[model samples]
Target: MAKGYIEFDYEFCKGCELCIQACPVNTLVLTTKMNKKGYRLVEDAEGKCTGCASCALVCPDAVITVYRQKKAS
Candidate 1:
């Protein structure tokens, strides 16, 4: 299986939770940390992301970026 991870653009996230809801692996969680805009940030709770891009697709702010590693042969 391909390994995956996500990066968040903290400034752009609005704490909408849409991405959290869309994540199939349940990797994302709302954090106590806040950005300059004062919106709560979301983070990868577990390192189990599949790079499916579901969270990115649902993010209205386009804050999430998913990266996948190619499977070894």
Candidate 2:
């Protein structure tokens, strides 16, 4: 089956958690893992993303890039 994913620019992320709230699939979450600046970052909690880009849309820093995998027929 086709699946979706997101690539996050952790360095640019401000840990605002907006993306986590915007995600429709509830796949995104904030982790205890810190970035280079010691700020917690959002991560893909579930691998079931649908590439809706809702998380990307709400990100103030534009740190998310989404990709979709095509399923074989």
Quick one: best lDDT, which candidate? Answer: 1
TM-score of each candidate structure, all chains considered together: 0.92, 0.87
- Model 1 has a clash total of 0
- Candidate 2 lDDT tens digits, 1-73: 4578899998998899988888877888789998898889888987879888899889999999999887667
> lDDT of each prediction vs. the true structure?
0.89, 0.87
- Give the range of the ten consecutive residues with the poorest summed lDDT in model 2: 1-10
Candidate number achieving the greatest TM-score relative to the actual structure: 1
- Candidate 1, residue 61: lDDT: 87
Q: Give residue 13's lDDT in candidate 2 (0 to 100).
A: 88
Clashing residue pairs in candidate 1 are: none
**Which sections of candidate 1 miss by over 4 Å?**
none
